[model samples]
Target chain A: MRHFVFSLFTLLLACGAQAELRVFATVPEWAALARELGGDRVKVYSATSAFQDPHRIEAKPSLLAQARQANLVVAAGAELEVGWLPLVLRDSGNAAIQPGRPGYFEAAACVDRLEVPSVVDRAHGDVHAAGNPHIHLDPHRVQKVAEALAARLAEVDAPNAATYQANLKAFSGKWQAAIARWEREGAPLKGVGVLVHHASFTYLTHWLGMKELGTLEPKPGIEPTSGQLSGLLARQQAAPARMVLRTAYNPEGPSQWIAGKSGTPAVLLPYTVGGTPAAKDLVGLFDDTLQRLLQAVR
Target chain B: MQKRIAMAAMLAATFGAQAADHSELAAIRAQIDDMKRAYEQRIAALEQKLAQAESRPAAKPAPATVQSERTDSRRPAAGPASGFNPEVSLILQGQYKNMKDVPERGITGFWPAGGHDHGEGAIEGISKRGFSVDHTELVLAANIDPYWRGQAIIAAIDGTAEVEEAWFQSLGLGHGIGLKGGRFRSGIGYLNEQHPHMWDFADAPLMYRALFGNHGSYTNDGVQLKWLAPTDTFIELGAEMGRGANFPGTDRNKNGSGAAAVFAHVGGEVGVSNSWRAGVSYLTTQAKSRAAHFAGTVDDEVEGLFDGRSQNFIADLVWKWAPNGNPKYQNFKFQTEYFQRREKGDLTCATPEGAAATVACDGMLSAYRTRQSGWYAQGVYQFTPNWRAGLRYEQLDSGRRDFGDNAAYLVVDSYRPKKASAMIDYSWSEFSRVRLQYAQDKSMFGITDNQVTVQYIMSLGAHGAHKF
Candidate 1:
C-alpha cells in the first residue's frame, strides 16, 4: 500500500510538470493570441467560439472546470465579458486567477477604446461603460495586447520569461510588417461610407479611415425594428453607402433586406479568427476582412 | 648730443610696445576660433544623438502612429458616482390564478408535513383566485473584501418582508475549495438552491410541495463547504450543517446543528451543442412534535403529532442542448429529480374538543414508521430569442405507513398523487417576462383541480446573469 501510494503521488507530480502553464481565454481571439505568445509551453482553452456572442455566453460547467485548472485567465475585459466571466471566476476556486492577481490579463486594458458613453444608463441599451472592447480588429491594437500578454505570461511563469519575450518580438515583427502591407493595400478604402449591423467594427473602421453612415440596430444590443430599418433605407436612398457591413455571427436577414432594397452590396467580414473558412488565424482574419471589403467596392 | 640719444630710445620703446600689442591681438583671435570650432562639434554630436532616438521609434511606425492616434481620440469617460456601490436589484411579481374552491385540501396517500395549505387555495404562497401580488424580492450583493463576498436577498409579500438569504462566501480559498456561511438555501438538490423567480413554472413542483410546506423549498441558517475536483469533467462535492427549523423537521431548541447534508455532482459536455449533469444527495434531521392533519371517518378531522428522525435521499439529472453552443437563438433543457424519505419514531392521534366521541378520541400513542418518495420531470424549450414553452409532470408515492396502535383511528388511503403542468412565456428582454400556465392537479383523492394562471415578473436595476 505504501509503495502504491508513493507511485500514485509520483504520477501526479509528473502530470503537473508536463504542462508549463494553463490558460483560459474568454474568447477565441484572446485564445489565439495566447497560443501565439505561449507557443508550445502552454495549454490554452477558449470559452467561446468566434461564432458565439461573448456578451451572452452561459457560464456552463465545462467553462467552470476549465477555469478551475487555469494558471492564467486572459479576457477581453472592459465589460465585454461582464455577464459571465465574473461568475465563472468566482466559482472556479482558483485563487491565482482572481481579478487582482498577476495571472489575470485583460487585453482591452492595453489599448485605447472608443465609443465611451458620457452617461452610463441602460436606457441606451446595454452600453459598455468602459468603452468598446473590440480592440483586436486593429493590428496595432493587437500588437499592443500581445506585448502586454507576453509580459503577463512572464510574470506568472518567471522561468520562461526570455522565451516569452522572444516570442513577442517575433510576433511583433511579423505583425508590424503585415500592418504596413494592409495599410498600403487598403488605401483605396479610405473615407469609404458603410453601414454596419452593430457597432462591432469601431476599431476596424477607425483603422482604415472608413466612414460609418449608420447602424441597423437602434441601440447597442436591441434587434433592429422594421421602422428603424426603413429609416436607414430612406437615408441610404438620399446618401447611399457603398456597402452594408456585418460579421459572420450576425443574422443575415436585416443586412440582406437592406442591401437588396438599396442596390449597394452586403459585405460579411470575419470579425475574428475562425469566423470564416479563410480566417483560420489572426492574420487571416484581417486578410479576409480586407479582401471582402475590397471585393464589395469593386 | 644727450637730447638726440633720448629721442632715439623713446622711438625704440614705442616700436616695441606696438609689436607686442599686435601679437597679443593675433593670439586672442586664434583662441576665439578654437572655441567656436569646439562648440560647433558638440552641438553636431548632440543633434546626431537626438536624431538617432527619434529614428528608432520611426522604424516601427505602426505602433507609434496607432498609439498616438489612440491617445488623441481617447476620452476617458467619468464613471457613475455609485460605482463602488453594491449591485442592487428589485423583482416585481404578480399573478392571477383560477382554480376550484376546495375546503381542507391535502394530498392523498401522503402524510401532511406542514407544507403549503392547498386547502386555502394557495399554491406556493400564490393566491388561487383573482389577482394578487406574488412575492417580490430585493437583492444586494458585493465583494466585502479581497477574501470574502456578501449577498442578501430580502423577499416581501403582502406588506411584510423577510430575509430570504444572507450569506458570505470565501473568495480566496485556493485548491478548489469554497466556504459559505449564514442563512442560505441548502445546496442539496438542483432545484433547491434556485429562487422561485428563476423557476420555469409559476408554481413549485408537487414533489417539493409535499416535501417542504408552503415554503416549497428548504432554507436554513448554516455553513457549507464545497470542493471542485481538478479534472476535465466537472465534479463537485459539498456538505452542509444547519438549524433544521423548516419543513419535514420541526425546530428544536437544541444548541448544536439539527440537520446535516452531503451532496456530489458530476457533469460534462457530449459535443459542442450538448451538456449534462447528474447529482445525488442525502439529508438527515430530527423532528419533535411535528403537527399534521388527516381525514377521519364520516367527515371528521383528526390531529396527528409525530416525533422522530427523518432521512432523505435525492438524485437529480439535467441535460441541455443548443445549436453549436449558441443559446441566443434556440435552446432546450430537461431536468428531473427524485426524492425518497424514511421516518421512524412515535405518533399520537387525538380528536378536537367539542367534537363527538370518535375513534380518534382514543388518544393513543403508537410506534410509527413510514417510507415515502416522489419525483418530478420538466423540460423548457426556447424556440426563438424571446419566446419559451415548458411542460412538467410529477408524482408522489406513500410507500408504507406503520401507525401501530394509531392506525385503527387514523385514515390511510391507498391512492397516489400526481400533477401535470404546461406553460408558455414571452420576454421582451432579459429583465421582464410574462407567462401563462395551465395545470391538472390530481394530488387530492377524489378531486381533480384544473388550474390556470397568468403571471408577470419584471426586474429593475442591476442585471443578474443566469448560471447553467
Candidate 2:
C-alpha cells in the first residue's frame, strides 16, 4: 500500500513539471530579445529565419495553426505585412493574441519612428506610406520594445513578476551602454555616402546622421531599370555616395553593379536579426553590424 | 536487556517519523533526545552516587504523545502555478507557366466589339483595349502570433505586396452567428478564394479571366458573414460585397454592387486521397455607367446605362497519389476546374429595326442575354520545396451560346462574336514569371485578329498577395 501511494505521488510530480512562458516573435532578433528578457522562464519561436526574406512571407495553414496556439506575439508592424498577416490572424481565429490584446506587441510602437512620410503613394510600388518598419537595428528602440514586452508578460504571469522585472532592468542597462558605444563608434558614418534599396535605410541613416544619398531602385518596390541604374551611375560619378548599403535579404545584383561601376564600397548590413551568421541573435546583430561598418570606414 | 534494546529501537522509530513532518524543530529535539539517551549510563551512575550521599524527589517529565501530535499541521501546501504557449510555422508557394499570345486584357465598358447585336443597328466600338493586374503570385507566410506575422509574396505580372499582419480578431459576437468583418478579401470563387501566392501560373487560369473582368480574384470593400455549420469535418460558409474601382474614360462606377457566394468543401483523404469543392455565386450591380457615345469626339452624348447581373458556378477537384505515403506530393498533383457564367441586362437601347424611320422610338428593351463557360486541366510537379513546374491548358469564348443576344446594343452592333484563346505558362515562385500566350479574337462586326503576348515579371515582397 505504501509503495502504491508513493507511485501515485511520483506520477503527480511528473505532471507538475514547471510550465514555460510562450513567446512568439516575427524575426530571430525579436525572439532573441524575448529570450534575454525571459531567461530560463520563457520559450521563444521565430517566424522568419536568417535565410528568408521578411518582407515576402506566405501565410500558410501551418502558420495559422501556430498563431492559434501562441500566448504572446511580437512583430515589426506598420504596414509590413499589410497584404497577408491580416488574413492569417483572421483565419487562425485566435482571440488572445489578436492586435490590441494584452499579448500583442508591435516593435514599431515601442520605438521613435523615423522616415515618416507626409504622403502615401502606390504609384511607385508598395510604399509603407507610414515609414520604415525595421526597428531591431536601433538598440534604444529594441530596449523600448523589450520593456514593453516585459510589462506585458508580467500582466499575465504575476507569479514571476520580479524575475521579469529584474531581467528587463539588467537588459536595459546593457542595451543603453551598447547604444552609447555604437553612437560613438558610428560617428564616422555621419556625412558618409550611402545608396540603398527603397527608403528602407532611412531610419538607420537618420540615427547615424549620414548623408541622404538616395537609392538604386527607381521606386519603392520597383527593380532598377537600366536607365535608372545609369542615372544612379551618373550621380555617383559626380557626388559619389561612398557606401552602397544593401541588406542581406535584398538583391545584391543591382547594388554590386552600382558598386562596380561607381567604385563605391558595398556593405551588406544585417537588416534584421538572423540576416547574417554573425547576427545570430538580436544583440549580436547590432554589435556585428556596427563593428563591420566602423571597421570598413576606418 | 532485551526490553532496554527494544525501547532504544522504539525511540529511533519515533524520531524517524518526526523527521518526515517538521524537520526544523524535530532535528533539534532529536539531537537532545539522542544526547540524553547516550548519557543515561553516566546519569544513572551519578544518580546512584547522589542517592548514596543525599536524596531529592525527581522532577516529573512531559508525555511523549505531545511530540507526535504536532507533526500533522506543518506540511507545505503546493505552490500556485500557471502556463504559456508558443506558435511557429512556415508556408511556401511557387509556380511556372507558359504564356503564348493569350493577350491578357482588362474589362472595358460595354464595347460594341465584344457584345453581339440581334439586328436593328450597331453600337460602335467604344473602347480600344482592356487592362488587368493579372500575374502569378507566390506567397510565403510565417506567423507566430497576432503581433508577429510575416508574409513574403511575389508575382510576375504585378510584382509583390508583402506586409506585417498584426490585428485583433473576434472583437464581438457572443452567439455562434457573428461577423468576421475586417481588412480581408471576400470569398468569390474557387481560384479567387485561394491565395495567388499558392497558384500555378504567372497568370490566372483563362476561366478566371472571363468571369471577373479586369479585377482578377477581385478585392476591395470589407465585411463578411461567417457561418459555422454543424458538421464533423471543418465546414464554414461566408458571403461578402465590395465596391469595384474603375479607371479612364469610363465613369468611376463607385456605385459598387453586392456579391454573395457559397462554398462546400470536405477535407481528409481517402483511397488515392482527394479534396473536392463546388461553389456558386451571383453578383448584382445597381451601379450605372455614365452615358456616353462611341464617336471619337462627341459633345454631351450621354446615354443611360443598365444595371447588370452576373452569376457564376465553379467546381474544383484535386486528386493526390502520393509516393510511399509522402504528402509532399503537392509537388506532384493533378487538378482541374470548370467554370460557367450567365449574364443579363444592365442597359436599354432603341431598337432601330422596329422603328418607322425613327422620330417615335423609345428604348425597346432593358436587358441582354449572354452565356459563357470555360475549363482547364493543370498538373504540377515540385522538384524542390522552393521550386515547382506546372502546365495548364485553358480555353474561353464569349458567344451566343444557349442564350442569344436580344438587347438593343447587340441589335444595333450587327454583331457576330467569338473569341478563342489558349494559355500556357511556367512560373518560378512568386518573384519571377515568364509567360507566353495566344488568342484568336473575332467579333460580330467581321473583325478578326490574333494576339500573342510574351512577358516577364519580377517582384520584391513589396505589397502583393500570396501566390498559390
Candidate 3:
C-alpha cells in the first residue's frame, strides 16, 4: 500500500512538471534563441551540444523522451540532421510537433539558402539539397530567424504571445547594433584570404567579405586524402591566406596540420551561441566570433 | 538671298561633275555596311561560345564553390529534390576470434536452444577460430510518401544473402499510434531490435545465444502496433502478432498466427545529464515439431523434435549520463536485462542410421517439461571522443527438466552457464569502429573457454537512425 502511494505521488509530480510548454531544439544555438524568446514559459532542451557534430547523433532514449512531450520542435532542417532528426521526430510520437505543424519550425526554410546545387549529383559528397543549414553564424540571418522563431513561439503558446514579441523586439535591437559594431571593427578583414576546415563558416565569410582560399575537404563530407591535402598546401603556399578557420566542433588535427605547414594563423571560432566560454548567448556569439577573426588577422 | 542662290548654282554645277564621285561614295558605304555586319556576326558567335564555356564550369563547380565559400559570397542551394533516392547504406564487418579450444559443440542441458549451430564458414560470435568476414549488410530506406515509409535490410554471410528485415511503417497515423507490418525486429528487450552492427561488444551476450541462438528471438514476420500515451513522462505500449516461423517456433503452423507479444515502457529525466528508462515485455509462441540438430564429436550427432508452447518474459532497464547531455567527449551507459522462459512439450530424439552412434536410439518419443532463466548486465564508458571501454556479465540457469519414461535414456546434464566479457573500442568517426573484446565463457559443464576477438565495423553510405 505504501509503495502504491509513493508511486502515485511520483506520477502526479511528473504530470505537474510537464504542464509547462516543453521545447526540444536540435542544436544549442536554436535552444538559446528559444530560451530568450520563451523566457520562463517554456522548458527548453537541446539534443546536440556545441561541441558535438550536428550532422550525426545517436537518437538516445532521453531525446525521444523529451521530444515525446514537446510542444514545439526546432531544427536547422536543410538535412543538417538528415541522419537522426527525422527518426527522432517520428519516434517522439507527438502529433503537435510533427512536420508542417505550427509547433514545428525549420529555420532553414526562412533563410534564402546559399549553395543550391544547380545540377544533381552525389559525387560532390554530402550536400544539403535545401542549401546550407549553417545560417546561425551570420548575425543578420540569425536576427531574421529569431523574429520568425519568436512569432512561432507565440503562435504555439497563445498566452505568451506578448512576451515572445517583446523578447524579439529587444533581441532585434541589440542584435542589429552588434552586427553594425562588428562590421565596423572587422573592416580590415574584408579582403583578407582564409582556409577553412569546412563550409560551416560560409555565411560568416560572406557577411564579412573575406576572400576564400579553399577547403581542406574539397568535398563537403569526405575526408581529404594526402594528395588533396598536398594540393591545398600548394595553393596556400602560392597565395598564402591570412588565417585557417575552423569551428569548435571540427577536428583540430587537420586544420592545425596545414596551418602549421603554411604558418597561417589558425582560428577556432565559436560556431554557436554556447560554443565558447565567452559566447554564452546570441549577442556574445557574434562578439566572440568577430574577436577571434580579428585576433587571427592581427 | 542672292548669295544663297549663287551658292546653290555652284553646288549644282559641282554635282554634275561629281556624279561619278557620288556613285563611288555609295559603293564605299555599302562595303563599310557589309564589313560591319560580318564583324557583328563573328562577335555574336564568339560571345555564344564564351557563354557556353562559362556556364559549363558553373554547373560543374556548384558543389566545389560551396566548399570554397571561404571568400566568394555566393549562396548556392543544391537544386530541388530529384525525384526520390532511397537512403542506401552498406555495413561491412570482419573478425578474428581466438578461443582456448574449439569449445563444446552442444550446450549441456539447455532447452529450446535451437538455431545455435554456426555454419561451416561463420566466425565472429559463435563460429570458428580463425579470421573471417562476419557479415555484410545492405540497407535501403525511404519515405513512400507523407503517410508511409519503408526499409529493407539484406545480410550476406558466407557468400549467401538473406533478407534480414523488410517493413513498412505508417507515417501519418495520428494520436501517437504507429503501425508497422512485414518482417522486422521485435521491440521486446532494449537490444532485441538493434542489429549486430550496433552492438557494443564484438559478440552477443550468452543469454541471447542460449535463448534463441546468436541472433535473439527478435525478427518476426508480422504486424505491430505501438501507442505512445497522450500523457507525458514517456509511456509507450506496443503489441505484435507474427507468423511462427522463427526459433522458439517452427514452420509447422498450418493456420499461421503462431506468436504474439506485448510490451510497455516508461522513461524520464532526472537532471541536465541523467536519464533512465525501464520496460517490461512478454512473448508467447506455439511450436509444433520444431527441429534442432546438435553436433557431437565423431558422428555422435543427434536431431531432436520439439512440440510445445513457450512463454518468455523480459524486463529491461537502461541508464545514461553525460555531463550536459552531450556525449562527444565523455558519457556513461549502463544497461541490464532479465529473461525467464517456460516450455512444456513432447520431444522426439533420433540418431543417424549410418555412422557410429554412441547410444543408438533410432526414434524415441518422450514427454518433457523444462524451465530456464537468464540475465545480462553491461556498462560502457566513453572515455574520450574516439575511445570507449565496456564490460558485460551474463549467466543462464537451466531451472528444471523432466523427461517422462526417457529420463534414464537421455543424456542431459544439470548445469548453469555463465560468462564475463570486457572490451575497448576506438571510433574514427560515426561510420567506422574497431573493437577488441575478451571473454571467459563457461557454458559447458566441466570446461571453460577463454576467448579473444578483434573486430571491425565500417559503414558506407546512409543508414537511417536506429531508434533510441
lDDT of 2 by residue, B266-291 (tens): 33334322323334444443223423
Q: Please, what are the lDDT tens digits per residue for candidate 1 over residues B75-191?
A: 112133235688898999889989888766667787675533435534435744778887789999988987898999999886679999999998899899989999998888888
Q: Which lDDT tens digits does candidate 1 get at residues A1-298?
A: 9999999999999987886799999988889999999998889999988778788788788988999999999988877877788888888888888776787788876765666555677778878876788889978789888988999899899999999999999999989898888888788888788999888887788788787889998888777778989999999867789999988777888999998898889889889888899988898988999999999888
Candidate 2 lDDT score at position B227: 50
- In terms of TM-score, the best-performing candidate is 1
Superior candidate under lDDT, 1 versus 3: 1
Best by DockQ: 1
TM-score of model 3 vs. true structure: 0.76
TM-score of chain B of each: 0.80, 0.49, 0.79
Model 2 gets an lDDT of 0.52
Give the per-residue lDDT digits (tens) of candidate 3, residues B1-468: 999999999999898779978899999999999998677546544543443233211112222222222211112122344336887889999888887654344456675344434333223333567787866899998778767789999988765788999999876776778899999999898888888888998877777766666565468899999988755477889999999577777666376588899999888677757778899999888877676554443235666667898888999999988766656668899999999988888877766344465445446788878888889999999987679999999988878877665555555567888889999999866678999999988877777888899999988875567666
Instruction: DockQ each candidate and list the results.
Output: 0.22, 0.02, 0.18
Winner on DockQ (1 vs 3):
1
What lDDT score is found at residue A91 in candidate 1?
83
Clashing pairs in 1: B115-B213, B115-B214, B116-B213, B116-B214
- lDDT comparing candidate 1 with the true structure: 0.82
Taken over the whole model, the C-alpha lDDT of each candidate is 0.82, 0.52, 0.76
